[model samples]
Target: MTRDISGQIAVVTGGAQGIGLAVLRKLVAAGARVASWDANAALNETVMAGEDALALPCDVSDFASVQAALDATVDRLGPPAILVNSAGIAGPNMPVADYPPEYWARIVAVNLTGTFHVNRAVVPGMHEAGYGRILNIASIAGKEGNPNACAYSASKAGVIGFTKSLGKELADMDIAVNCVTPAAARTPIFDQMSKAHIEYMLSKIPRQRFLEVEEAAEMILWTVSPANSFTTGAVFDLSGGRATY
Candidate 1:
């Protein structure tokens, strides 16, 4: 069932394209005003073109940047009732032993620390509003572990832990904190991984196909919907039956 969100405010990180953009468009269509927070300044400048939507440049990896972006968002749109942390990178594909130390640092900074940043920045405002929904986009790799992708896997696992812990923190409130773990999807993030790494992911999906970005968006839409009450600290699986835990 479609939940009513006629007067809701939303913020979607990485909203410039891919899954974030998918979610942003769906929210707009559902009558919710949206802010597209992305690191791509160009995308933010040109992607959204109307009164109900605006784009703000934000690098989720940077706490200071995340804070500034959050402030700017609240100033432009009202306090966001919904926040989707979709900004992330796959990092370079390599075994943990061969992974570049610097690259590993970068991936965790964005995938894990960044998730924390978005949630920390948004939660206070949500607490003040007495209502909120936070959706973290994790991956199946976080659960089953993936070879040649140490940093990506570890960081996502951290996201799952964080989501679960935070969900419980706000369990008594109207706020909901949850995460969705998806199998590989053909997003631009694929540009960063090796062909072997990509194939490895495809071979693992029992469905014999990669997930579509829109399908991920649909799950995100519901996770952040008002109808999603009574569910927090939960992990919604979208791994083609790869994960039912």
Candidate 2:
């Protein structure tokens, strides 16, 4: 339970709700000065209003928005020593042939390109500080390739690959860059998925249940903690026996 991230500055993207919010709350409880960045301005303000945390409006898909949020975070809480890149979207599920091109592009923009933008913006500060931890949230679909959710699966796959490449690039530093491939959690993201698609995902999980955000957060907290110093460019599996490799 000792996260060893006390007094650190941490940023959790998509922190207004779901897994991001879960991780943000955990970081604060572990004594980190936390910033919650999300595109939902009103929801973010409302959710973070009661907590001792900074809530910033950020559209991760846009580099300018990501940059502004980073600047505000640094100005207010100092450079982030920990980053949880949880901002993502689950585009509507459909067969690859029926999926709209626009939807595919948008999903990639947020889930893949957005990961790159946030990581790219934060790394320089971490490099200068000579210490940092980063955890990018990916999905089991990225590894196994889920049916009817081609965009989400593909975008998450990109996250896995990006995490590996960036983690290796910064391996010489004290920074640890890693990713988690989680089984589907019953979050608001499920709202974008069809009932059949959701059922399909659950059936694939040998645990026979959806993942809990808190369960995911617990693993994420440690993965981004100072204790995780030796591991980088690795993928942590949170798939509840669903991941074979």
For every candidate, C-alpha RMSD to the true structure in Å:
1.1, 1.4
- What is candidate 2's lDDT per residue for 62-175, written digit by digit as tens? 999999999999988889999999999999978988999999999999999999999999999999999999999999989989988899999999999999999999999999
Off by over 4 Å in 2: 49-52
Tens-digit lDDT string for candidate 1 (3-88) = 78877999999999888888998999888899888999997787786677889889999999988888887787789999999999
Candidate 1 achieves a global lDDT of 0.91
Candidate 1: TM-score?
Answer: 0.97
Q: Give each model's clash number.
A: 0, 0
Candidate 2's clash total is 0
